[model samples]
Target: MTEHRPVNITGLALKIPPALIFILWIAMMATLRYIFPGLNYELFLTPYVVGLFFILGIFLVLAGFFSFRKAKTTINPRKPEKTTAIVTSGIFRLSRNPMYLGFLMWVIAWAFMQANLVTFVFLPLFVFYMNRYQIIPEEKILLSQFGDIYYRYLNKVGRWL
Candidate 1:
């Protein structure tokens, strides 16, 4: 079941910033932890897990950001059409959506930090929403802008490895 939403309510396919959506997911996870305090578990390696994921998360985000900067492409998710180049080096070589993957890692860190099973449900939801509303639209714009070069890169990398 999807929302009774109009297709492209404006010329823009994206309405919300991905960062804001990430924040919303984090907020929802926190709310779930508060409302369902009993849904938590004991993880002896919680600190290690959280730290590793947090570090990897930040690393991937920065790597993606820097790669975009070096490639002279638009890093702004709101303007995929403005992307001047298709970056497939560094972190981009691993995942097409490295920044989003980093965000997912941060979400994982938050879930483990809470030690709450309920909050973990947002993981798949986050992926689903991002693929449906964010990545697909961005891919369309990239494909239109960069054509087969973008298509080849899409085939070469996993969306969220």
Candidate 2:
């Protein structure tokens, strides 16, 4: 008999809330841009912020890519059900949530390039969502599947280092 694991309530809340917030953020930004024709809020291209965001985004994407490749795992958070291996190498050694880290970096880049204060809303929301849904639930499954090996790895690596 196949055992059906129930969905996590926090995970559900996390996933839906940020998705809606992200959509709202996009809508609001588009509306504001339409209303104010001269307002140029480029989070990634902003003066000094440009360098920071560009570096961050590149670092995160590369880190996550290498880790996912090393583990031979999918980095998609929406489809964690398909993960074939536990990634604990490269950037994974530094952070347990490299994909989320990459997303965060992207958000930071968005905030800088857009230079819109409102875009900041999605930053924290994204982190909250990943922490609640992706990281926590995936950790549970990994602990259950990999046993003490996973725990040892967890001990060695910080969740968001």
Q: Which candidate is the best by lDDT?
A: 1
Residue lDDT tens for model 1, 24-127 = 99999999998999888998999999999999999989999999999988888987767778899898889999999999999999989989999999999999
151 Cα displacement, candidate 2 (Å): 1.6
lDDT of each: 0.86, 0.64
For every model shown, what is its TM-score relative to the native structure?
0.91, 0.67
What would the per-residue lDDT of candidate 2 be over residues 64-159, giving only the tens digit for each residue? 877787778876655555667777777777887665565566566656666656556667776776677667776766666566777888899987
Backbone clashes in model 1, listed as residue pairs:
none
lDDT for model 2 comes to 0.64
- At residue 113, candidate 2 shows an lDDT of 62
Worst 10 residues of 2 by lDDT: 1-10
